[model samples]
Target: MSNLLSTPYLDRYTVNLTKKIAQNPDNYRAYEREPVTNRVLVSLLKKIQNSPLLVGEAGVGKTAIVEDLARQLLASNDKLLANKSIIQISLANLMQTSDGESFAYKFQQILNELMANKDTMIAFIDEIHQIVGTGADNQGSALDAGNIIKPALSRDDLQIIGATTTKEFHQYIAQDGALMRRFDLVEVPELSFNQTANILKKVSSQLGGEITVSQEVQDQIMTLSQRYITDRFFPEKAIMLLDGAISQAKLNQRLAVTTEDVADIIHADYHVPKYVINQTTDERLANLSQRIKERIIGQDHPLDKLTMKIINREAGLTDSSKPASFLFLGPTGVGKTETAKQLGILLFGEETNFIRFDMSEFKFASSSFERFKDKLTTEVRHTPYAVLLLDEIEKADPEVMDLLLQVLDDGRLTDAYGRVVNFKDLIIIMTTNSGAKAIQNHHAKSDYIKNDQKRQENFEEQLEIALQGDGYRPEFLARIGAMIIFDVLTLADIEKIVALKLKTLDEKAREQGFHIIFEPSEVLQYLPSFEYGYEYVEGQKVVSSSIAKYIADVGYRPSRGVRPIDDTIDVYIGDPVAQAIIAKRAGQLEDFNAFIFRALGNPPSLTSPYGEWQTVISRTKEGNYEVI
Candidate 1:
């Protein structure tokens, strides 16, 4: 067996694994892949079906197992593998011609050589699925490489270890029954977190240079790889991250590899925010509510509930598999979508991490639902840690809801192509206007008062009833971590929002070398007031006869919440200021220092309804409109 017949064809197109290992013994250091390698060895020693098909995800160490088996055989006392050498058939070299006859003849010569030297040579084909139709003259040709080697494989005359991804194995080899039954299937699964960590440590020790990876850095590598690099399997991704960090450290002339090095690589490759990569989990979760509140105004109660659930989830008090999910029940334009956006910024350190899906677009049919699933799964696979906002969830089709139920329950979704996208790191938010009418009706009640806790509780109960009436299943609602009902915008909230809008306008004006300022108090005085009479004294509610100033009167309506304010600003301030800047740039108007928007005494007009004061934008403090 040690001195078999000459193998000219094998020598021409195959790589001698034993000779390669003998050349560099240090390169084949064993990790935790021994079990898989032993399985392959046992398959080769079998009296029947001596070939083994290595099935696993890409980068899950299928090829490595074969190489490790070769290394083990190089030092083993077993007679079966004493003189046997594992030779990998170079598919690239063997399939050098497209002509069916040429390739089939070449592959047959190689198979014949393997059969002649079966006692001393074992064959290994990486990506063995490629051989299925290799060198076929046409799509209907059956005389391909796979068919040519079937006789040898069926008789067990050649011990061939084939490796391919599970997807390819099913797509190609599993379809051919004759080719499928000849090889014993050895499944290789992904390594666990601790196993991957140990592999990284082993590889780090072998660096053996000025480049050194600390234990903490190795741990971070494993964690980040598992968390952010969802598209790839463990050990390989972690090792790649470790290698990249070490390469970066060496390139910068540094002796030690730090966490920053790992963070830099992950941030550059995955577009994960540098702050998110560098910050610890607790640091990322600190002051979450306060940070979100800075951007989302007048949603304190909802924000409080949302943040509490988030904190609890991050603290491991909730289901670890499922994502931190919430259903935002509210009227239009009441900071529902904005809250989701702010959460993305606060948690993931970037606003782009907020992914929004308008469920209205997915309401049509099963095809539309398929499209939604494709987009959702693809995006989450790419950016696992982000905020996913499904806008107007009620508008989505029932089929789409079925898909979401799976995600909400399992924290993972399998796409049509059988890839499971992880949602555990996502913040799932679904917003709906299902209870909007109920909210508006509750607020329209004459007894509605500011800071009325009991009224607020009653409003929530009404909203829940409304949601149930809107066809939401009980189990669907129950799976949501929290159902936060957004309160209607108040007069004070509108004033603050107006100030924010005006500030934005002023910044835009400044970009054109002009200054603009809006007197918030004077501006609020001119906006129309709502037809409700109410006031607050200390913590007590009081009834009044005077008109009440609510957000609705200023433009925040039930159908279009706060949108009129945006349009009003665009028309009155943004448009006028833009015109003024354009006129100045064209030398059509006199240069003005600043435009002040303030309310002043209006001329007597019986038809006017803006009270006794009118809002004006002028160039002076005397309330003159000369700039116009």
Candidate 2:
């Protein structure tokens, strides 16, 4: 671990600087051609003549150079009075506050305090250009702030060090000759990757950790992150990442940091900013779809088709003048509505992007079409790139559909006032349990009816099917690019989906800094219990109330979802007596060993009419009995 950091004075901030080597024997690091720059800066410091400007690239140590010089000036010069003062002030903090005050107000008081302490003045201002219009009451050129600074610049004992970017310096300070004439300016160029690498290596040594991060790892981190590293931000983050990797390695009981480890740490902890956020909408949409798949299992075909449409609509953001809309139709408890909510979260950085209006909430307004456009206008402006979800689209009066024709076709709307509302960047998702009974019958229906009464019952079923059949308008269907039919979640998908939820619970356990690993059978037990209601057709969903009911009954009925084979799960299963039967020592043993695939129900029964298996486990006279 002590590969290079153990050398004396190298870990500490201050050391003698006049000689290339430290005044005392100690291993140290110097920047690329930075010594020459340091010497130039040191030379400027000694000239107590005009105002001195110390400009440099961020993180290249503009502030450090001044600190080093101040240390040398006081320590080296016997004539240098203890009364001489060197103060550091951050200019950016002043601008960020409201009711801004001038930096000049404290100027004289600061100087007096420094003189009382017997310190000569060296006031270093970081980001000095922020005060271009320094005088608060009246707006004036930066010269006014500069002119206020002029008196301090004229003093015989005073020495000023101002740091700023070359571009900003030229625009604000350099333009005013009166301000420019008082101080001498210096340029600080950005360092190459090699130079940056050296500084990070030194920082590792200083922090007392032996981390030999591979050059390739460093290269990727720097390359992916270079643009955001401007003005001192680069070295700080890289060193911290290295430090984190070292800490993680130690905790995981590893000998040294590896390349893969650093990448994982960075991706998890840092959000590397891209230069132009281009095609980001499409990328965001794709990530959203992936996140959904992770949460909702076993609908690959439908998920794929629907995700493609979401991606296509997102791609339209590139040419926002032409935007697309969407409509989702399916049976109750399917994921049609949940998909919209999830997309809003992924795309807009939160769930706020989509404002769902239950079609029934607006059903009354549907009777009066004139008020419709006004309500949509107000909602649209608040959530510009919003997903306007019209739930129960079929329940809406025919009049509402008449107005929807405009929003669906043109990506634009005309309000009652004749004001135009553009929806070129909006995404519309409509969901309903519209054709549930018909969908249910399509998947499972009896064609035979004997008596006239039986024949009448059959007619009602057929009529419901006909309402959503081929006779349904082609224009309505064509307007919606992707209408995913959600079938009742099959046992496999529901099992897999519940497994994902259990995994989430495990993650939350870890985040709370605890250990949790569930036995495979615990969550698998909840799957078949979802089989009672949802009947999948061309459209069905087990996501909403059905899911809520199932979860409330099954997931929470146990202790935080680790339900034992016992009927202790009292809440959601809707069977309290059955719960008492499962926890019986013999019965519980039987249930845990039991395997009930979809069709094999009775012989391997997990639940009796009274309660779950009699008990989870029981001990025999010899020390082992049975698990149900």
Candidate 3:
């Protein structure tokens, strides 16, 4: 404290850290007492190499460690840095205010000022990596800030302390071999959960108001901050979380910080809500299968397995760093993508939380990686707590698959700006049609699909051979929890799906001021039929419209699945009904009834009380389907 008054060199720098340490001595005591700070002090006080280079990740207290050294030198009467100014230099401010003074000239003057008081003064450079190429012209001169300081650093005349991130240390400092060896490196690690909790408690005490924090809240804050707040490190992020919670508690007129208060603050800061992390697995798992089945049809096998994995994830039994990744390998038009949408709504409470990437669009070799970088990382980063669907994985370029391997294994991807986008809270579902042919062949011959136990085994074996033959690497396949194979929709399954589709069609009809009913037929010949190969046409609307056309033009086949039934209904049933409503044909058709009329020789006509009515007479000059 007495030494600061004697040193006039501190006046040149904007901040006199030594004098500031005197004002609030306790503020710097915590860092001074830390073990890493002692190590840095030992390095800076060495006989030959007196400079200490502090290196660590951002927010890991590298600069704090250096400040501790300053505080200690001021408080104690140590000869090494005692009676020294310990003026901290901001490289940015130094260069900014050089005022036409040459970079070399400005740095030399500072070095001369410090060296003149050799044993009594020390210069601290924070973000010291900025020195490497401080003032280099296009001609590439080596007369930079680092080079200027190298001679002084090597001579042991100008005592200096440096702090920088590990990334910049290697990138900038390590490039200059001579300058690198001059300082002893001190690596500071991020504080552990317990250590961070201790620091938060100490901070709360020092503040001494209504900001009382319990050990449990601090522990939870540590865990939550580490998981959700990927961009920041421990102690720093934990402290921010705790302080923010304290501020929120004060604003609410609360006395102390509660877990709920901390959670609310964190939820506000990061969109990841507390309900997501602390979900009630008991109730969710109990109704998981039933909830999923309501949306998906004929995927009981895969759906059950997926539900179990989700239960395990929600139960906190699985790895938090890696998401519960699954590969939905099956034929087209199965409930693979639909299951993802349903799961998104189930887990995240909204279907909009489902983010999808159509791998078919990423087939081009040139733009595949760009698409992956642009959409995958950006979307996941924005909505970390959502379901990501990569549809039609087989159609994607191998580069896309290669890029996905890291995300599958680690649940993280470095974005273009070098930010790590977290996927631990995400449910990733990748659907592929790579093994559709083999799966079809297996079901065509074997009756083992009826047995759930043997069915999974047979499906697995066939898919393994199919995917391996298709050149999907085994390592990539191994990371996924399961490669769920969806069976081809059977006639019974399609009938159930048709019933479901009709319920939707009925709702739409009622919305438009009409009520259409499907007249019960013994064999549901009213719906469109799917042949063996062309069974997967995607939606019920297409199915109904196409089926209505098929029944009127071609007629239903016995082996047809439920594909395109909605299309048939829309074209023959919906279009005709809408036209009748517009034409005011209320007397002729008092009600709309859809049924299969297999009048072998009779033209496609609706047997009505008014007269014979063809379903599709012809397109009128006004471009309306003339149904009468």
Candidate 4:
């Protein structure tokens, strides 16, 4: 035990920098060129009590800067570090021993050794924050490692270089005034794009000799990593992308990394849709509006404005930190939700990427918004690139609306656990019925498309007032790219919706080997006659004039919306046909066409061999369906 105190502790717990550098020269090759290296050296050369504390975010090259300083000290002509050695002391290793001794004893022996060779030694401590409160039974212990080293550092008894993250520096070292004052802090920021590009090139030159990375591929790595890799800081994120691209090339038994190769790696690493990242802007813009229009009928005003915003975003004109956000204002069943779904399909290439939350669900109960907040953050974190539809935004509680401010303003949300969820890659759509009354009033007086420019301006002005009345702040509206007013569906628009819905139903029936056709007039007759100044009734629809007259006498009418068409089709068409098919009343359904519509008789019947007989579907005087 006495001999251990006499012998030096360097052989057991410290790695000699001179020997390590001699054995592996490549480790310091790129380090010398890194910008942080100069700052570290300057900190070390201070006039009094010089020990550089490298502080930065993790993976921003703090430890690497220390190593570069070590390399520089070894290669320099200056006597302070010339022929002198830098050895990294493992604080953890010093705390443990087979020999029975207090942790204070072992800590003192290591310090004594450094003191003996102080002039010729510089000690490096990585994760230097561990020195505080370690090897102590509790906080404020006199025998702790931090207390043992304080006097040595104060008198310049040992030159030490310490590395830790900015968080740890404040958490550990800043607490003790005596220990904190001894070292100068060197802040290492993340490398710039040009610097990161150079590092990637040097890395490829060093280890990726067999696989070539083109200049175009390097630029792509820099852009993609900066944009998509949110959880990590600079150069590290860029380097990871480069490494992944090289691996991808090798996996495919290829030699060179092209732009496509880098893109493929990014897609796999971040799960960004390949088409979204790789498609040319012109091509995407050319087909976007047409494709969205196929599923979203009417509302061409919103569609056109939305198309422009999307094209601008895709072309990289706006700030990338904020997501593309839109507030869809109008009445129910006016293609608001459908526009969001179609947008999801257009951008992400799938309907499953559409995330919808009925904001009304978060309005009533005390814990409902809390539960919804957690769910919303989790879903967006996992599916960062998606269409998030907040339906009935006006129905949500004010507290729930507060949660969206960060998302709408910064394009990021910090969850309860402090993890940042990125929304920059998302398309956020918030639908509301706040402006419905105003829109309905205007549409009843004039054609929705009349003098389109003035109409849109007036609509926007009126909708803005309604939204403000509903408690949305003007700043919240400003953050959104557009507040698109989905137009009220006219009879013609409803007809188009009916056809689209029937087409979808027909496809489903075809899958089951049944051929079905609808008599257009019969379906049209069932559509409620929506006209100017008409009032909407609940649970009752005027399918024919007799019913309309009767309902008018009572001063009630079904509102203007497309949802009734779907419900009417389901009742008058879908239900009766399914019943007939089950009963075998529509004989030999397969390989024979069956017609579904309002019937001529008291009970609705499905007619087979549909086109052979001239069946005209019409409304009787008694407000009933008749086939003539």
> What is the alpha-carbon lDDT of model 4 when measured against the actual structure?
0.72
lDDT of 3 by residue, 61-169 (tens): 7766666667777766776556666778766655654377666666777777777767676788989999998866568897888888888888888788888988999
Cα displacement (Å) at residue 375, model 2: 26
Best by lDDT: 1
Clashes of each: 0, 50, 25, 4
Error of 2 at 616 (Å): 24
TM-score of each: 0.79, 0.38, 0.78, 0.78
In terms of lDDT, model 1 sits at 0.79
**Candidate rank order under TM-score:** 1, 3, 4, 2
Task: Identify the leading candidate in terms of TM-score.
Answer: 1
In candidate 1, stretches whose alpha carbon ends up further than 4 angstroms from where it belongs are: 46-50, 90-105, 129-155, 166-187, 205-210, 250-258, 320-323, 362-383, 396-423, 444-481, 509-553, 575-596, 601-610, 616-628
What is candidate 4's lDDT per residue for 1-628, written digit by digit as tens? 1222243567866888767886675676544245567666666666676888888887777666666666666778876666566788888787676767667787788788888877677788899999888788766566677888888888877778888878889988998888889888878887777888778778875656788888888888888898778878777888888888888888888988878778887777777777767865586568788888888888887798898898888788888788898998777888899899988878787777899999988886588767877999899887788899999887888778877876778788778898878888888999988878887777776555655788767777877977898899887778788778777776456656666777687677667655444534444444334222122235453222222112112221126466666666565556655664565544643323344332221111265322221122232333443332
* Model 3 backbone overlap count: 25
The residue-by-residue lDDT of candidate 1 on 1-628, one tens digit each, is: 5567887777777889889987877788658887888888788888998899999999888888888888888888888887678899877787676444377778888888888888888889999999898867876788887888788888878889999999999999999999999889999999989898888877896863668788899888988998788769987899888888998898788999988889999988876778688787799888888887777778887898899898888788888888988999878888898889888988888877999999999999857788999999988877777999999999998888988998999889887789778898899999998988877776676754635888777767777777889978878888888888788887678767777767777887777777775644433332222123222335554332211122223445657777787876776667877877788788997657567564344322468544453345656333333535
Candidate 2 residue 592 C-alpha distance from true site, Å: 9.8
The models' CA-based lDDT, in order, is 0.79, 0.51, 0.70, 0.72
